[model samples]
Target: MPRWIDTWMPGSGPEAPGGGYPGERLGLPAQGVSAVAGFGRRLAALTVDWLLGYGIAALFLGADVGTSPFAVLGVWFLLTAVPVAVFGSSAGMTALGIRVASVGSEPVVGVPRAVLRTALIALLVPPLVRDSDGRGWHDRAARTVVVRTRP
Candidate 1:
């Protein structure tokens, strides 16, 4: 009801002019392939990836999440970094039909950038902080954006 309400209430208040979908600035579609990935999907993908990392840690690294957090985190780091560097998507992201792309002109998220992104992700705070475009701080720092692969 108050004019200040819009500042704090997400997705509420009177419609602000020029408000467009996320990824509009990147020249992506509004609802189809290449559109900015929604938080739900991105979260789901992260869940899947985390579970996978946990499993890998348990089986190969002999690490339990409760007893050996660093092992699980290390696994997650590799799981996120290598594939993203090579394919533009991690295993979970691929399964969920989303991929990380460049906000800049770069064609792919290279190893160094992917490692940096994963490192920030390991810190866990960066991903929780999203921008107006719905990109996490890690993505912004790496000049990458997550986009949908399917409509």
Candidate 2:
């Protein structure tokens, strides 16, 4: 009945030999709202973005694509950087109800920042992040954060 009930268990006194539980102090909640529409939504968005990029690449490279890595980079650059500059959200993030914004600012990332972020993402492994806040390395690299938009 005390406002500050120290422990949940029946006999968890201050001097209890064993603590109540190992992680009882970490009162972190389930993060339901964020998680509710996370991986699935993000994955779907990435798929949409990839399709868009692939289409663009197809147009640029044509049927008989050459073997220049620069060309491939150029295509990917156009696919990602252009869209991020024009639209706050990439095709994938748009579909997934997320937008990229400056970490400490209300403004969206500019073309150069977007290019860096896109480059990291295109590198593939760098974008795969598993932080508690659900941000990828690319997000961190660009000083940007991805937020789930309300629609």
In lDDT terms, which candidate is top?
1
lDDT of 2 by residue, 1-151 (tens): 5334323212222432343322122221234322223556666777787766566766777864445556655665676687786676877777677767665544668888888888888787765653434546676567665555753
Which lDDT value does model 1 have at 74?
88
Please give the distance, in angstroms, between residue 107's alpha carbon in candidate 1 and its true position after superposition: 1.7
| Per-prediction CA RMSD (Å) | 6.2, 11.5
Q: Model 2: runs farther than 4 Å from truth?
A: 1-37, 65-73
Tell me the deviation in Å of residue 108 in model 1. Answer: 1.2
| Every model's TM-score | 0.84, 0.64
The 10 consecutive residues of candidate 2 with the worst lDDT sum are 21-30
Give all candidates' CA lDDT scores: 0.83, 0.60
lDDT comparing candidate 2 with the true structure: 0.60
- Please report how far candidate 2 places residue 115 from its true position, in Å: 1.2
